[model samples]
Target: VVGAVVSITGVSSTVTSFGTTVRSDLVLQNENHMFLDISLWSDIARNLNGQELAVLGRSGPVMLAVCSLRVTGATKGGYSLTSTPGTRCVLNPVSEMAHLVQS
Candidate 1:
């Protein structure tokens, strides 16, 4: 699917005033109108929109869209993060890692 991230689910809201553990499930589709499923954590809270993500199934490659997002699930107290967020925190935009190969 080439469509954008139409929805996000499974986020815990019962966190402390400070950050807490959580998980986010996403929905993606494309021009062909196929749906893809993805999950991410709160760490990417700031910079994940409009980024390109790819996955392969029995078919060919597909792109995941991430537009508007909704945080779901309930929070109670600090527990070990079920699924770790993409990044607990953001890294330097121009860090030396940019020179490293990715994918």
Candidate 2:
């Protein structure tokens, strides 16, 4: 899915039986104004913390192209998207769809 970045939450950590788990919520909105929350896990979440994220959207709403996502039921209701190991994200993608979303 390709959408405009609305906001990204600060990285949060949780302790599980495996070990410490890190995640961040990246909220994106499509041209139709529908919102989707994608959970970015591990290194992907850590890399966007603090200043890095600000830089990404400093110019304008960051355009994102996300692939290989997993659909899961949200806690409150409905469904939310989650990043899988194969998930790939591209910022400011130079495509017609991205341009439409940007405008």
Candidate 3:
């Protein structure tokens, strides 16, 4: 999905039986005003956090394209997207759809 990043939480660690998983939460809003909360994992999460801060400092919205996410019900209610190992995230992507989302 393509949207402007509304907010990004700081990176944190979760200790699971499998090991330690680093994660961050990013909230995005599309042109239609729909909101999506995406859980970015590992390196992607940390990188996106830095990008969000940098772009926001310049007073520009952070445009993001997140793909290959797994849709699941959110614990509080509706639905949310989770990044898998295969998920891809691009910041300020150059594309027709991304342009539309920006405008």
Candidate 4:
């Protein structure tokens, strides 16, 4: 499905992967009509928001996909897939990624 850019938001972090924890805010966003939201790490936060992003999610029998997004806020919303909001990087499915790039 195709969705327009909506908004990007920032969020706070309490720990890092290396165990060297630090508190920081990162940017995230919701795509067009998707119930899920996307967030980027501090290193890429600035470049992520308000940018068109392609996303994909999968389970045993369910698959979710989205294209184009607008990062919006700083607070964590209910749409996150990770335990910590805006901390983990979301991966787009390879098939969806190929579809997105080809279009």
Per-model root-mean-square deviation over C-alphas? 13.1, 6.5, 6.6, 10.9
Judged by whole-model lDDT over C-alpha atoms, candidate 4 comes out at: 0.35
lDDT: worst 10-residue window of model 3: 8-17
Best by lDDT: 2
By lDDT, the candidates rank as 2, 3, 4, 1
Better of 1 and 4 by lDDT: 4
- Point out where model 2 deviates above 4 Å: 9-19, 57-85, 96-103
Question: In terms of TM-score, how similar is model 2 to the real structure?
Answer: 0.43
What C-alpha root-mean-square deviation, in Å, does candidate 3 show against the real structure? 6.6
lDDT of each: 0.33, 0.47, 0.46, 0.35
In the predicted model 4, the residue pairs found to clash are 7-70, 7-71, 7-72, 8-71, 8-72, 8-73, 9-72, 9-73, 10-73, 10-74
Note the residue pairs that clash in candidate 2: none
- Models 1 onward score TM values of 0.28, 0.43, 0.40, 0.26
Could you say which candidate leads in TM-score?
2
Error of 3 at 27 (Å): 1.9
- Please, what are the lDDT tens digits per residue for candidate 2 over residues 1-103? 4444444444333323366555555554434344545555556564655346546744554543333344343345666555645444544345644545432
Off by over 4 Å in 4: 12-14, 17-35, 39-42, 46-98, 101-103
Q: lDDT by residue for model 4 over 22-98, one digit each (tens)? A: 33343433354344343334444433333323322222111222222233333456342333442323333344444
Q: In terms of TM-score, how similar is model 1 to the real structure?
A: 0.28
Kindly list the per-residue Cα lDDT of model 1 for residues 48-79, writing each as its tens digit: 43232322322333322322332223336522
Query: What C-alpha lDDT, on a 0 to 100 scale, does residue 44 get in candidate 1?
Result: 43
Name the TM-score of candidate 3.
0.40
